[model samples]
Target: MPNRWLCLLLLPACISAVTLDCKHIRIDKKDFDLSALGGPKTIHQQRWLPPSISNTTFTIDLCNPLKKLKGIDSKEQCPSGTRVCGIEERYNPIDGVKEVTEVRPIAGEFSTSHGRAMDPEVTRLKESSNADQEGLRIELRGGKFPETRQGDLQKAIIELHCDAELTGNEGFEDDEAAVDVAGYGSMSKRAKDDKDDEDEDEPELPDLDKGKSLQFVSYKNEKDDVGVLRLTWKTKYACENAEKAPAKEPGNKSSGWGFFTWFFVVSFLLIAAYIIFGSWLNYTRYGARGMDLIPHSDMIRDLPYIAKEWVGGVADRMKSGGSRGGYSAV
Candidate 1:
């Protein structure tokens, strides 16, 4: 019972320690805040290889794990704590009949151990690599493919570039095309209607006021190298001047005056009022002159002398070095 309670108490702390903060990402000397693009973004692509057609779906979330959406199944989705995931389905004709040959996870963590250390591997792109390319590179590993020479752990690299106009929906229309080309057939009528209704209900610019959007640029599976997937993302958050906007609460209004500010302001006003009222009283009642009209006049007058004496005593102490423990010679 004691051990169970201890584990429960420590769970929250462990979770917090490993949580990745995508709002503040630093690479080399540059900083990026991608918190605006926190949700998952997905892309689908189809390639026509000689004997088979390959259809791949890639999903990434900068701030959280990819959730299992309505049409996606738990088995087809990546394991929990996965920030980036890719699944590939191959269709081939066997005995004059088209069939699904293979369905496998191409790029993403397969083990639950990823929750222990979930920080994404990020780095800056080399200047000499591409003159036109400038931004941070992120690497996600833990995929397994036995056919590759790069060992069991496959990897994916995503390059984030800065673009002011993209909203991460640039290539979403290609999903239908990919599905058609792969001969995977269309989605069910209910799903299609739901998606269309969602599109109609959504605002044209959902993230315009909050922050900029992320756009999918391209995806390339390195055939020669094998087990490597390269992707590019464009967003204003990846820019050098990107800054995380201050979050606003729904009903709360921002005010410059805080507790200490009000405290000091109130103190000054009260002191001023007291001084003015006291001075008037002294003048009308007793004809007090000069500094004597002030309240607490004696204490106020002695303040300068007190401060000067204090300074002098401190200086003397420093110069004399205080009495040592040794007694004077008799």
Candidate 2:
């Protein structure tokens, strides 16, 4: 009975852990519709990561006002007459709390074209009620969100979709084209919607093979103050049946000669052929005696004669020196 009483006491604290004043902190619901676009479809995949995301931005509107703005703070203790439109809280996939970022609100009303208007009395009540509340235009800007990996070495499949009309590419023909991800991964076309036969076997096409069986991990839809909706998801790629590319053979390394190499080889052969042709012409014109006209044979024949002359000269010098030595001593 005491344990039950303890649980009852903890429940209220858990509910009020994140104290967001919903009435004062109002976001135009029309600005953010998670279901505005079609369901999430697989758009991209990577060997071990999601689609490259550099930075993120969130535009918000606070009821009252601040002239100069920097960024959103974690505790959200903004100056007076400014309402807290939204709080930017970033959470890691694995680690719990990465940051409680600031909420920057623009200094204007929500555009009528962009979203519906709130009641004038309700707006007045929000400002009059909260002392530290001011209307603001907040843009939450932060560095790239940290990417965490799965426990095991698993590929990540990223699904993406956006409303073409909202993104201003309504007439774009290939907006729905499959994203061929660096050839390491591929996106498949969404399956044809069949309400009556959900269990029917799908045709085994090249793009729709077993490589696409991604296990669902989590899903989220992000929409800015504009009506544009971006749907994204992260899942584990079905890599069990992923086919491995064949290893390159040693013979394939030198499969073809390049232009310069081929040119040098052909030039060498042509020069050799030209030399042989000239030699044959000389031989036909002047018989075997023409071979003696070649400088190679002439140099070989003179080598022995030159050596003999050099030896004779050295012997003559030695004899002269011996004769002069005996005479000088006398």
By TM-score, the best candidate is 1
Give TM-scores for every candidate, taking all chains together and pairing residue i with residue i. Answer: 0.48, 0.16
Candidate 1 error regions (>4 Å): 1-19, 50-52, 70-73, 91-119, 126-132, 146-151, 167-226, 243-330
Worst 10 residues of 2 by lDDT: 233-242
- Weakest 10 consecutive residues of candidate 1 by summed lDDT: 203-212
Query: lDDT for every model?
Result: 0.58, 0.31
TM-score of 1: 0.48
- The digit string of per-residue lDDT tens for model 1 on 214-326 reads 33344544655445667677766666766553353233366568999999999999999999999999989999999989989999989999999999999988877866744
Report the error of model 1 at residue 292, Å. Answer: 79
lDDT per residue (tens digit) for residues 1-330 in model 2: 999999989966753432222223333321222121111122221121111211112212221222224463324433322221222333222222234343332122222322212212212112343334322112211111111122111111122222221321122223222222222212212222332455645332223112322222221223322211122221111111112212332223555789999999999999778767766766777663555534355666889999999999999888787575556653
